[model samples]
Target: MVRKFYPEEFKADAVELYSSTPGATIKKIAADLGVHEGTLSAWLRAAGVTTVPTAAGRADGGGAGVPETPAEELERLRVENKRLRADKSLLETEREILRKAAKYFAGETTW
Candidate 1:
């Protein structure tokens, strides 16, 4: 099998992303970048950086450090809640549209 080569710029950006976000893991970043975990590790080492243990995201409920301040945490939660509400609304709208479409196609609608 032929090996795929990623751009050096992409590898650099991936390393920068890993370095900038402590809550992000190599595996996660690699998956996001469509590269292998070992490939990311190699790039990191090439840059003289040692990969640390994986850090959990907020989804995991904790990570590799102290908790955020109460206000920060609250703001984060508020943002997340707003996003979830929007998602719920979108899903409801889609469901309603699908139901109407199904009824119309089945000759149950006046139109």
Candidate 2:
């Protein structure tokens, strides 16, 4: 005969296994929790946990240290520079159009 586990029981066991064996493999956790490995993998994925231990925060490409700050600042500045350049070019074109319109309405002839 097969036994059925309640939802709450399964959830509690999964959480317990996860916390108790922080670095355990998915297969290990599944075996320990008596659930399929795929089920455990889905649970972890749904919980936004990664198989890689340190891939959560340090996965931003900046391993560690204070050097990350300057890299982040440089990226910010590059984005800001691009935006400012676009705005400057647009303003220049608008100014030229306005100057031409003003001169045309001020008795200036282009013929």
Sliding window of 10 residues with minimal summed lDDT for model 1: 53-62
Instruction: Provide the global lDDT of candidate 2 against the true structure.
Output: 0.60
**Please, what are the lDDT tens digits per residue for candidate 1 over residues 1-111?**
788899999889998988775445677788888887788888998998655432233322335655567776665667657757878999999999999999888896466
| Model 2 lDDT per residue over 16-94, tens place | 5664543345666677667776677666666666553222223222244343356666654565577578789999999
RMSD of each: 6.9, 18.4
31 in model 1: Cα distance from truth in Å? 0.6
* Residue 25, model 2, lDDT: 57
Over 4 Å off in model 2, which ranges?
A: 1-68, 108-111
Best by lDDT, which number?
1
- TM-score of the candidate numbered 1? 0.48
TM-score of every model versus the real structure: 0.48, 0.37
